[model samples]
Target chain A: MFSLQGYGPSILEGTYLTLEISFVSLFVAMLLGICGALAKLSGSPVLRAIAKLYTTVIRGIPDLVMMLLVFFGGQVIVNKVGPLFGYNEYIDINPFVAGASTIGFIFGAYMTETFRGAILAVGRGQLEAGYAYGMTGLQVFSRILLPQMVRHAIPGFGNNWLVLIKTTALVSIIGLDDMVRKAAMAAGATRMPFTFYVAVAINYLLITTVSIYLLKYLETRYSVGVRRE
Target chain B: MDFAIIASNIDIYLEGLKNTLILVSISLIFGLVMAIPLAVLRTSGNLYVQAPIRAFVYFFRGTPLLVQMFLVYYGFGQFEAMRESVLWPLFREAYFCALFTFALNTCAYTTEIIRGSIVATPHGEIEAARAAGMSTFLMLRRIVLPSAFRRALPAYSNEIIFMLHGSSLASVITIIDITGAARIVNSRYYSPWEAFLTAAVFYMAITFTIVFFVRKLEKLWQRHLMPLEQLDTKIEAPSI
Candidate 1:
């Protein structure tokens, strides 16, 4: 019999926070990813160079380092900048905002690659065809390119998401009350770290497994009307 | 911005770099050795034989490395039996605990990578080995594993970089890796940018080095796939 020792509610709350951070970061990542992808694909040399730099640096550095750099460094920068303004008081960055943004910024690089490849996979002729029909660039993108890119993007997007969910664990190190941190607190109180850590791991497994199923369903949905071997 | 703190703390960073290199190298070596056999078993047709290995891979890949590291470092000590066991001494040390956890985690990912390559080995090669009167074991040794290893190199290199990055987690349990060094420097000088940015630079250096070497290895191993003119040029360059 595994017992939470009166810590069940707290663990549940941590799990909720973890999910919240993951989804918020996912949203930010997707937004940046699209912009980065377009910039990379764009004809402007400067935009391409900036996007290239973003992906290269982010991918090269570890996520934890980025998180710490953003969290602690951002706090320092904000406080330093505060005195320049009318507000002179020391301002602390919220852990939630810092954690989510850091994760998003880091994963944005990965998502950029995924989206770039997916957009390229949608073929150039289709967009040209849309143009031939007198469609605007936005219309070609939304009506033709976006729909076709989804199927190609899903596999890479799904992989990024799984990694992103796991990356949320790093947020706990930044003093966020995610399930891992909650588990740590409970383990410290009860001296049953094995039980609590295993419990947290199982919760992660459940989320990932469900996400895999949903991704598979989405893949199938998007592939509808397309022939498969 | 504070170069003075970083300059003063270079020795500490070097010591942390040494620990990080030791951790990443040992785990990667052991992980690769463990993965080969596991990968072969994973590619087996028997459901019973495959299921256990599948589950092992699933569990490792499905969970976060931080949790796994904590489980090995702190969770094991929670059990009375583990405490009294001979392994307790090793588990008690953060270094060994991190090495053990990282090796297992990398082993799982490497197994899946190797398994994919193994399964993708051309059927013609296997048939030729059979046609030459080779036994299954001999064929696997001579034909399958070599090609699989070659194909697996690119993916395995990525895993190595990942392991190097993951080794930073050892700092959380007090192992004083590069990240740990940065944390100490940050706390001592209250210079987060100087400390962590230096750590980030070190990590980026290692990552680029790995990428460079892997690219070289790929070029070497995949030479046969090059076009005839390029291969001829490569061969004749030294003689000329």
Candidate 2:
């Protein structure tokens, strides 16, 4: 009968949890990505090597494996460190923190590539002009490099964002009470798994649809002065 | 940290690797086959044919594969008709459910990648084919598809790797792929680092192998597009 008798509020809460995880993870990802891109671009060999190793290994493995390792393995490490610091009680790792950081770390590798390409796409002449106009290094970066890099980065960023949003669903596997988990619970209780999962699926589609539009709007907003080919 | 656990349990890991490989290869093959027509339809200039396919691709690509797998494996059973249907036996198996979800998920991504390259195929080449008295079918077969595939190779290779990574989700439905193997080891020996890191190493090996072969294939396919001098560096043709 496709009935939803009593699971509406919990499902809404799950949706909020999903959104909160996604946004927090996205912020962390962007921060790591910019740092990674800068490190790879820097002249220091050690920085470049470390960044390269991180991106290569992170990109090579599955995110689910990363999630499992971070959640459980991280707990072991935290507990190990806790007793050493004279705090002997077991420290429970929050699934939210574990899930967000893992997802953030995984996508940071991808975003590094996108940001690197975007940075490289900005012309050297433009940076030189900024320098010639009595601009400091930070001024050159903020004024000349940042805006154009964002424009060039938007397509790849949009792609990464879409994937990142979908990737958040994996957090449920690690026992986060996200929308998918909420749906599973509802499905089990109501014995209408189809309806509940479909509900989750529809919510995801709606979010993605809205994201695509919002990304397009940002693209337009950033592309204000540029002429379209 | 516990290397001994992995060393002692290598066989179980190998079994998991085998399952992962089977799931990835079968799903990739099926997904690729299904994707070709969908890719073509996706780019067709008609709305009716394109609309539904676009919706299908969007729905699949927009949601998580984990959800799709759950919807198929658990959700399908909710319907009385699906349970009573003749195909229920096949659907009941966890392996089939995983395979079906993986195939459908990869098909959506592969379709978009192929469609992008198909649309990107140079218009001038199509014109040349048409001018050479080629029919539409012949043009598509000889020029369009080949050129499209060549252009698509890089992106398609990424999709293959993504699918390989995605195959880990089979563990969620209890199919026991590499990730599942790691989970088992983690639960048993309580050494998460050794268990998942071992599986991670296996994935990295597979990923490197794919990247190596794809790079070689790209170089081979791109020969004609490269300048003659760059094409045969060893020959060192006379300075001209």
Top-scoring candidate (TM-score): 1
Q: Candidate 2, residues B92-158: lDDT per residue as tens digits?
A: 9999999999999999999998999889988899899999999977887899989899999988999
What DockQ does each listed candidate score? Answer: 0.85, 0.90
lDDT of 1: 0.94
Error of 1 at B36 (Å): 0.3
lDDT of 1 by residue, B165-223 (tens): 89989989998999999999999998999999999999999999999999999889999
Q: Each model's fnat?
A: 0.78, 0.86
lDDT of candidate 2? 0.92
Superposed Cα deviation of residue B32, candidate 1 (Å): 0.5
Task: Give one digit per residue, the lDDT tens place, for model 1 in A1-229.
Answer: 2888999999999999999999999999999999999999999999999999999898678889889999999999999888888788779899999999999998899899999999999879999999999999899989999999999999999999999999999999999999999999999999899889999999999999999999999999999979988
Off by over 4 Å in 1: B232-240
TM-score of chain B of each: 0.95, 0.94
Collision pairs in model 2: none
Task: For candidate 1, list the clashing residue pairs, or say none.
Answer: none
